[model samples]
Target: MVADEKKIFGHPRGLPWLFFIEMWERLAFYTMLNVLLLYAKDFERGGLALPSGQANEIYGFYLAFVYFTPFVGGILADRMLGYRRSVLIGGLVMAGGLIAMSVPGTTFFYSGLVLLVLGNGLFKPNISVMVGNLYAAGDPKRDSGFNIFYMGINIGAFLASFLSSGIRNTYGWLMVFRVAGFGLILGVIILLLGWKVLAHADRQPEKDPNDAGFGAVAGKILMPALVVGVITYVIANKFIPDFAVTPATMGFIIGMIPVIIYFIRLPRTVSDKERPGMFALLPIYVAGGTFFMVLHLNGSAMTQWAADDTARDIAAPAAFQQDALPTYYKNAGEDVPRPAEANLVVVEDPAVVRMFGQKRMDEQTLAQITARYPELELRDFDPKAQATDFSGEEAALFQFATAIYADGKVEVVEEKDAHGVPSYSAKIPEREPALRRVAFMRKTPGGEVFPTYLVTQDSFDEIYSGYEARFGHPPEQLEPGKWLPVINPELFQSLNALFVVAFTPLIVLLFGWISARKNVTTAQKVFYGLCLTTVSLLLMALAGLASDGGAMRVSGWWLVGFYAIITAGELLISPMGLSLVTKLAPKRLVGLAMGGWFLATAFGNKFSGFFGGIQHMMSPVAFFLVLAGLAAAVAVFIRLLLPKLDAAIEGLS
Candidate 1:
């Protein structure tokens, strides 16, 4: 139980306990996050099958609310619950959310997301505050401790990408959620076991006259924000329905009115001695928010690029290789093996084509229809078969067919015969799904028929047209079903965490060496981080150029390079921001200040979604250029404000 009895790699004994506790929790968190958008938009995998824009909006709102709740969590921990209890509570709730997501209904799925948001609010900021508490004021080890702590977060993230890939591929998506849920449960158990060791880091709730009470904050800031959000939703949908921003996003932005006003006025409530430090956090919040706006695109725009525009034909670990989908062949080399021609059936029926072309049915809807028609049989649509009495006329199908979706998961549409007894059509793959168009349909040896699509000639012309181009080889064809194994797009996210783990020690040593020789302020480090982010975006912009504005898939190395540059930038900003909040804020309000940092992150994450939602509006080159320009502007702004930021830090003990 004694915290000082032993050292953990030159830091407090409690550090390792907290580190692994966080590692497991983050494994669950990142596992879910990295797959969310893809799951929402996927049709072959029993996903929600939403449009890109709607999915991005949902992504933005979910992240925004997830971070936004930390504000309340921090307040509750400061005024009532201690850090340990909050962490435990948050961990358990998050586990439940993950489990709930394993259910097959949108209702359950959305409900699970809400639980995750609530649990994370309680868990995220408080655990970080505890890490800060382990170090004394002015401790030189504080930054390094946070860096180690940040490494724990990335370690989990790193594992999540691979674990998710393996699990989702082998066992399927729902199993991935179940496994993530269990991972969280294990994290909670670890925390319970280490409770005594973490005691020294837990702070008792204390009251200050200047501190805002929980009820007061809920009433003044939270309630008003909710009211504004509802009003904005209504107004946007009613009056500005065609506005570029979705109603939900519009509501989120306008709803920040109360929260923004409260923060702007927060300094006035604190004593004059503490006011400067509080004021200083405003710019830091802006910087943190801006930095994450670009960084978090890993789950949104960047992942989309990886999935669609980047070639994924490189060899992968044997264990990680998955059955390739029709989507994979879109931009693949002509040499990639395709299914045998005899195995494929071409559809000439426009009715069947339109049916396959519709948006896919989610599991929830499929379940409902199956319940309604207990005898409905699942069958694959074969246009060439005339033995069946059913006709391919569009209007005749309109009366009986409730819904039809791609893939075998929920591929039933109730059809009525002359007796009005309900039956179901066979499940068939979509003629055209997302980015690819069906060139042929394949029937597996097991008799499961599905459509396969390939890259358009335009894509081939752009990428392989020039035999002497950067790729350095002519396209070739291979025997059917002979395609090489390649990694999934989601797995690319692991690169960031891998780089973080690899680079953290180097970054720490380099910073340590520099600090020994000169006074390099934290603000200066953050400024440099922003500069690196700009460069990362520029790398992606060049990638866009290479891909000919997404006319063809480019090399996966572009994504690798992007992640490498951004990982370095992330190490500079993210952990430092966490450490900076703990150092600059008044002692009694550290939890609240930590919450504020997350709030800024929430804002930036929403903007990430915003950019992702609109990604198709501009060419990929222009899109990356805009983000790079934004990062450069933020870096310059931070440079100009460095003197004041340094003075504020110096003002601190």
Candidate 2:
């Protein structure tokens, strides 16, 4: 039946099912990731409100472990479950984790993350292995098949950002999880429906007497990893509290030692022909890891740049306005205000009045809030003083306060004394804060009135400083209730996915055209990919330079350009790496080798986080330059080894 089946896009009958399944899985994954950092740092919008460094640490560790688990999962699938069962189990587990994320509370959140990591381990590598299994040895369609499959992954990623933004904006962060969970469930259903069609690709390796069994691999790899990880953690804690490397990072690096040793010893166990291939894989692994360290910054440093440093005041398109566009905001706290809108209503709060008058503010809370607004002064409640006597800053401390309602309305409240004197009190809104628009009656070059959104006072100050320098005057303020819309930070993240979807087909065609005329080895493609990645960072470095080290926001096109450049590199390197693994790995260890690719990706992701953790300490240009230099170095190294790698890959495909 398999032999009689018609091909879809020059691939097997089962390819579409696997493609859609992967697409849906990535949709769920990217949807969750789109809002992760924002949710962690949000203060007024019911997020964890963690510091950037701490949040990035968690992000990095989560990504690292998620990729790491595939190593074990691949071994298990090879020996016991077979690819199909492992994939099914993984899909279901991931769906459950996504659903669990919708439940409120820190425990559920962390627990959900753990489940996702575990499930992805089982699902990710094995599924890719199945894709390769569908093709016979030396099939010309192999690389193209992976590319088609890769497109599916990007398609899901492309849609997720916009869809997640809409759901999060309309409902809340929790609802985003629910929607993503449903997407995964749909993917699982599709896989089940096509189970028989995909069955041919599911292989349970024939046991070889010389092959390392599951128990042996676990004891030598897993057990040693755990022991080393624990020892590293304790040592890092007791002896190196002030060390440059974090304990989590140190532990992860130490834990990988045994696995590294295992790979090093693997070539010795294989045949002489396989030995060169394995040796060639080592450099490829290093290059892959280094490349991903920059690529995965999309979730950490790049996301931060989108949130804190990009100009987002341009009007959203009508289509996006109806969905994801509406939910976008400048920061995590409040919604961008609408132009000429009166979403903020003044209301009186007696609690604020009494708290201000009685000097009942918690010292810690006062310190924290005041730290954000250093000029704010809290005056002791003077019953005899009239509200009119206080300055705007003093009045803001007690008499005037802002609160956001559940339905996204910002209210300003004023307190009245017994003598009918009005005092100002600021209230922190819970849930969604209504958009605050700042009316800037300035006209554009086209003579249309310019629109502006209310920025955080901090953001506003920075912007105003730059604006004043450029235009010779501060922007005119609008009367109360008037505002301009600000763009949501998460919306910027969609650009990379968008570029991937838009360009993948073109890139594929171009590469095919080139491949037909001239032999372009996978190693050569990866080398070019590294060069493009370096250029992407260099573009960012230029943006930073133009912005004077992030003293002001840069244009959104900077991000667009960066994503476009890097995504081209991604298309070249990432999918090619997967294809290379399937081509190079011995048939018996295909799944395990695929796991090795993901493991390298895991390390790169960890490095991305480590780089992000220190982002606050360095200027933007310096940070970007450092990454560019690393990528450039790797590109050079790959160039030096291209000859040997090309020779090793000869006749393999």
Best by lDDT: 1
TM-score of every prediction relative to native: 0.83, 0.80
> What tens digits encode model 1's per-residue C-alpha lDDT throughout 429-515?
433232211123344567654333222233234433443253466545333433346677898899999999999999999988998
Evaluate residue 142 in candidate 1 and report its C-alpha lDDT on the 0 to 100 scale.
87
User: What TM-score quantifies how close candidate 1 is to the native fold?
Assistant: 0.83
Total residue pair clashes for candidate 1? 4
Q: Evaluate all candidate structures by whole-model CA lDDT and list the values in order.
A: 0.77, 0.73
In model 1, the Cα lDDT at residue 520 comes to: 88
For 392-500, candidate 2 gives per-residue lDDT tens digits of 3443232222221233122324533222344333333333322221112233346543222223333333334544555566545434333344556777778877887
Clash counts per candidate, in order, are: 4, 20
- CA-only RMSD, every prediction: 9.3, 10.6
Runs of candidate 2 exceeding 4 Å displacement:
1-5, 317-474, 651-653
